[model samples]
Target chain A: MSDHLPSTARKPGLTSSAPSVVAAELDPPTPRKRKAPGPRHEDKRVAILRTAAQLFADNGYEATSLDKIADQLGMHKATLYHYVSNKESILYQCLVLSFGNLDAVMSEMEDRSVPPLQRLRQFAHSLALAQNNVFGRCLVLVGSRPLDMMPGGEIRQFQRRLDETVRALIVEGIADGSIKPCHPGLVSSMLFGSLNWVPRWYQEGGKLSIEQVVDSFMDVLTSGIAAPRR
Target chain B: MSDHLPSTARKPGLTSSAPSVVAAELDPPTPRKRKAPGPRHEDKRVAILRTAAQLFADNGYEATSLDKIADQLGMHKATLYHYVSNKESILYQCLVLSFGNLDAVMSEMEDRSVPPLQRLRQFAHSLALAQNNVFGRCLVLVGSRPLDMMPGGEIRQFQRRLDETVRALIVEGIADGSIKPCHPGLVSSMLFGSLNWVPRWYQEGGKLSIEQVVDSFMDVLTSGIAAPRR
Candidate 1:
């Protein structure tokens, strides 16, 4: 029972590892195999996370309470606590999920054997699509604020990784002559900022689709905003 | 007492011409004319606002209380409240101050006889400086959040004005054949996002000065990251 409970949602394993080992020894795992989380349980957990994320983005993280989230989801507070340890865990889950999607895009870029410029464009297109949704939008708008307040350095480390990945790509592009020579650091910040801002102004059910917006953004990024010299 | 309070800070006088007149008839003039706000009072008000802006930017607006701000300033909360109505007002003042500085730059650009491209460059330079400081940084970081939560629409109106100003500049640049033909709205969003992101990473005593960072950003915005054709 003690092994199952975490002190803080962020640092669940902070308590003695002895407790978990002792609990495992005492309980032999005979009937608990059937009690493990199933697909339905996982789906409910995801639903809670999705709802919490929208609430956090709509009302600020500090402004949002677990009670409000449960009420919004038409669930009891105890039921929400059953899935998530606390509000921070919900926030952490949302950010982790967002980072996972971005990492998947980065991995896709990495596996491709294309020119650096093409890789950059592909990354931009994928990022624009990712940011068009609520999860990605919250990651951008509320970015690092909620994480900065909570315990653990994982979120900040994730941010640094994202920065380094983009910066390295730009550097590679410049080295291969596929992209122009520019300060990679500044350019990465600019690129990420521009990409993240898409959901803020991108109108849903508007005339221009997400594809058009991403293309225009990529065009400005790649071809420059200045007209060609005569 | 009724005459002293305004309904909304942006449009304090919106409700009634009758209220002030009625209050004046009921009250006789007194020696309080000498207690009218002087330059010293105005300076104190500005100082309070400056401190509040820094606090709001560092810790979020909602998280920052008037009590904390007063404590930071070594004054009592009541004394601080005497200078401003509430935390929202402090945020509003910071935003208005930031907008005033940006507006001055825009006005200077308008007054100059330079070409539209030159004006755009100048505007970018001035914005970088303004944003590097506390007031402008708060305006960008806390941007429209507190204002949206408040009753007045002034901040949104201010945002629209800024959008119009930058969009018009881009339109002029394209017409003059200085800038490339692209969607002004998308380009403007990109440019502003990039500019607003400067304060996030710009170090005070780093190797590159503010001027260097601004120049590099402007260079990228103008020439872009793609290599020139032979």
Candidate 2:
């Protein structure tokens, strides 16, 4: 992944090949130079994570290897280890990274103070976008199998928290009289299951856009599949 | 699987030690006795399939092997092969068996001449039952991967046919004014995804019965999640 970084930000091995004068001009000896490594390292870490995610999605989590990820990034296996301690670490970080983004989106949605029904629609759209995105697709395709093997149960906890938030949204909708009164837990499961499975059949340039799919799902959820009572 | 067979059906190697009188009585020297191989062979085949399905569910299809299955059955690998051609064949058969049973149930539901809404409710219950069953759990866990490797396109074709039937039900419901107008393809995907994911969380003797889950799902599907308009 670092291999694709701008020549200036790439490892010294490649950057050193540039004319010495041009390199010297780009980096002036200053205290602020210390801040450069932080963002540069973070960017490289994300790049490795994104690449690993794509590989995990393409060839399942078990079948994928650290060597394959490094090969895909055009980096040495040693350099790959610098970003991630091991394959499981990569899997762990990939899941956390995707969930972090999704949690952030949900947090923003919560802050909107919209009606519960409208919140549900926004939540559905965000879920569709996140799952269909390259990173989240890996999370859904691999499911929670990686978390089962990993230590500390953080992933499971994080997932449970997400499920609870979804249930809470539904409960709120029911209270506000915007959503029908139903078993919040069951309805949440149906919503998540449907959203999670979107990546299974959704094509990038497919006939239906992600928004269209979300609209269709949300419509079905809000409006009974049965005709309105006469 | 053969190890659990009744004494009368036990392989000759194990049953030979029976008292001569009992053995003679069981065999009953007769011309028509030669025809017994038909039902006996079919029973052994079913035993092998049931055992294979259990193993496949416990351990994934790829991790399971012919040797392990034969060992589980307390039979020689050669004897196992006599019942099944190979491991893939066992997997292929396991999928076909489960899907075949579910397909039969759906067909029965279709023939009831009930309203589309009622038929959908019946379909939901049958789907939940089938997925929670031992055989159906194997199908959900292993997923359609085995079908991809299996020689014929029969499994995929069978699956497509099922999907079409589901969509047909929704379409019929819409035409008959029992179901709301919606995208049959998208709604069917949502319905199947929710139903299929049931095995992931449902425990047979858990707090909720399969009937409860089915009823909850059907309620949400038929009635809109939002409150009825005043």
The Cα error of candidate 2 at residue A217, in Å, is 1.1
DockQ of each: 0.48, 0.40
* Tens-digit lDDT track of model 2 for A44-139: 777888888998987778678999999999999999877677776667656655553455556755753687667777878877886777667888
Sorted into a CAPRI-style docking class, model 1 comes out as acceptable
Write one digit per residue (lDDT tens) for candidate 1, span A82-185: 78778766676666555535665666666537866677778787677666666666677777675565556555776676678778788787776667777888
Name the DockQ score for candidate 1: 0.48
Model 1, residue A203: distance off in Å is 2.2
How much DockQ does model 2 earn? 0.40
TM-score of chain B of 2: 0.76
